[model samples]
Target: MFDILVIGSINADLVFISDIRPKAGETVMGKDFKVLPGGKGANQAIAAARLGKKVGFIGCVGNDDNGKKLIENLRGNNVETQYIQIVDDVPTGVANIVVAEEDNSIIVIPGANYSISKDMIDKNMDILLNSKLILLQNEIPMEVIEHIIDLCFGKDIKVILNPAPAVKLKESIVNKIDYLTPNEHECKIAFGNPNTDGLLTKYPNKLIVTVGDKGVLYHDGNKKVNIPAFKVDVVDTTGAGDSFNGAFAVAIVEGNSLYESLLFANKAAAISVTKIGAQEGMPYLEDLKGL
Candidate 1:
């Protein structure tokens, strides 16, 4: 049985690093270029596995070299990849990323990620139900996410929804989620505004809004608390949120309270930004020492 099951997209990140972002219609040279394995789904799965959780991933990747490498990467991180499928016809998902002055902008080509279907979810129904918690993101199709949510509702399995690349969610679906983690921008898009009062009134303590550097604010039904981010020299902010979500799932599934989980996740994210690449920056359980 898995500690946390993540169902989302998988992609290869083509990253370009430079000192400054190029202006519109202008061409600029980058200092370095690399291709890294990434996807909201894969990143979170690896992040949790790195923290010693038995994480399983369910997603679609193209039947290609990138797919093989990504599978190897996940297996190397100790995540169960049995549920991952290699779809023919479609190419692997890819993200064209540019990092300038430590900030990044990305253009994602969904490719095989969009191939996630209802049949895939149904096929993995048993595996999905056997997990303690299910982690979801906006990378895959909404129908697939909704299907998974329907399966887990009232089944005693907890659900954590990280609405990245935010989309408007039905209240019926929102009410059923045990946790909702969204970054500042995502929160704004989902709710029209990121006013804490309005969001707290609606989501209560279930909402977690991650404000980069400023830290995270959470309302757990009782009260709202702002958990300050751990201070660190940031190298890349790409996978920081994914790291937080992954580590947070680990803590919650391990029976830690929400407050404690947030603190632990906060530290994990802080450590991630000090390194390069998304998965490369993730910290194991041993790395969470006196922050």
Candidate 2:
């Protein structure tokens, strides 16, 4: 049995850092470029594993060098990769990330990621049911996500859905998820409302919104609470949200109160931005001691 199960996308991030973003049909010089292992699913699995939780990842990758490296990277980070599949013809998913002037834009080619079918989940049903908590994201298919959530209903298993790359979800699906985590922008898109405060109040403890720099916000069943983010010099904002989601799952599984879990997650996310790479920047259990 695993402490955490992540059923989502795994990709190799092609990152480019440049001073100025070029206009349409133009080229510009870049300061740096690196290929790193990333994807909402893989990053969160590594984050939870680094934070001292046993994590299992289930996703699809193409049969290529990048795919092999991603699986190896997950293993190196102590995430179980046996459930990950290597598809025959599809190319591995990749995100082209351009970081310029303190902000970043991303374009994703979800090649093999889109190949994750309901059949895959059915085959892994035992692993899914055995895990204490399951983490999900929008990088995978909506139908598969809904299928998994429906399967876990009444099973006493917890689910954390990070609605990134957001799409509006059905009320039935939203009501079924145990925790709904979205960044400020995603929250608006997912719920189809501009009134963020009203949405938080509507869901209470179930809806947790991560407002960058300003920290996190949620309703505690009685009142609104904002957990302040730790003060730190941020280098790159990539994967910081994933770190928060992963750490929050670990904290919740360890039986921490909602407030305490948010604090712990905030500390983890703050620590992640202090470094450059997504998976590389995630702090281990010991790294949280002084912070």
Candidate 3:
């Protein structure tokens, strides 16, 4: 059985480093450009794998050079890619990422990612059930994500939903998820409330929010706890949240307490931003030793 199974998107990240973000109808010179393998699903999978967990991925990519390289990259990082499908017609998903002022803004073209349907999840039910924990993101179709959460309800598996590119979630969906990792903006959108502390209290240990550089926050039944992020020289902030979710999954599965898990995740995220790319910046188990 897999320690963690990520049911999410896989994409090629097209990164451009610029001094400033140009306004609409304006063009500006970028300092650098690079193509990197990323997707919330793939990045999380790689994150867990790097941390010494047995991770598997369930997603789709187009049958092309990008798709082939993405699969190869996953394997190189020790993520199990047997369940990833390659479709004929569509191109692999891609994100246009612009890194400016040490932060990133992205535009996603979810090509093959949108091909993930409820039927695909149904066909992979055994893989889904075999995992101890499942990681999800909003990059794929909403119905498919809802279907997986519904399928895991009352079952032994735990679900961590990272509501990126945020969308409103039903209360029923929230009730079924074991963990909800949302950034400040996503938290506001998902629950339709700007009062973050109130929401944290409502969900208790269930709601974990990542506030960049400041660290992570969650309510622990009786009280609210904030796990401060480690201090580091920041480079690219891409995939930092994905890194946290992946490391958090490993820590949880390994029987760490809620506080310990968040600490571990916080460190992982801090390390991720010290480098230049998404997957390229993910830390390994060895990288965590000194910190």
Candidate 4:
């Protein structure tokens, strides 16, 4: 059985590195460009797998070179890809990223990611139900996510929802999640404002909000714990959150307490930002020993 199953998008990231972002209808010279395998789902899966977790990925890609490369990359990282499907006549998902001064702006073309339908999920129910935990992101269809959430509700399997590229979700759905990890900006999108005071009151220990560089804040039933981010010189912040989520899932599955898991995840995220690319920057378990 897999320790964690990630149900979301898989995309090829085309990144351009530059000193500054260009204005509307303007162009700028970029220092370099690189194509990397990334998708919140794939990145997290690879991150967990690299950290030695038995992770499985569930998503859709096109029957093309990019799709093959993405699957090969996942397999290379030790993530189980039996659940990843290839759609006909569609291109694999792609994200055009511009990294400037260690920050990034992205425009994603959903492509085959949108083709991960309910039928696919239903067909993979055995895989989904057998996993210890499910990791989800907003990169896939909301309905598919909701259906999966409903499937996990009141079941033995726990659910960790990362509300990225944020969208408003129902209270019923939110209440069903065991953990909700959202960044500062995404927290704002979920609650109509960036403030988490009300969210903490509502979700209590279920809410985790990641503040870039500042660390993470979460309510732990009795009190709030703020895990400080590890100090590091950041080279690129693209996959920092994905690293955190993947590590957090692994830590939790390994029976680490909330605070301990948060600390581990914080360290992993800190390490990821110190390197240049998204998946390229993700740290292995050995790298976490001294951190």
In the range 165-238, model 3's lDDT, one tens digit per residue, is 89999999999999999999999999999999999999999999999989999999999898898999999999
| Model 4: ten consecutive residues of lowest lDDT | 193-202
- Backbone clashes for every candidate come to 3, 0, 0, 0
| Clashing residue pairs for model 2 | none
Question: lDDT tens string, model 1, 69-149?
Answer: 999899999988988899999999999888897789988899999999999999888899899999999999998888899
lDDT of 4: 0.91
Per-model TM-score on C-alpha atoms:
0.97, 0.98, 0.98, 0.98
lDDT of each: 0.90, 0.93, 0.95, 0.91
Error of 3 at 276 (Å): 0.7
Order of models, best lDDT first: 3, 2, 4, 1
Which residue runs does candidate 4 get wrong by more than 4 Å?
none
For candidate 3, the clash count comes to 0
Cα misplacement distance, residue 278 of candidate 1 (Å): 0.4
Off by over 4 Å in 3: none
lDDT per residue, candidate 4, 38-119, as tens digits?
Answer: 9999989988898998999899999999999999999999999988999999999999999997699999899999999889
Give the candidate number with the greatest TM-score.
3
User: Residue pairs in steric clash, candidate 3?
Assistant: none
Clashing residue pairs in candidate 1 are 205-219, 205-220, 205-221
- Candidate 2 structure quality by residue, lDDT tens digits, 1-291: 999999998989999988887779999999999999999899999999999999999999999999999999999999999999999999999999887776677898998999999999999999999999999999999999999999998897999999988999898998998999999999999999989999999998999999999999999989999999998887788899999999999999999999999999999999998877788789998888868
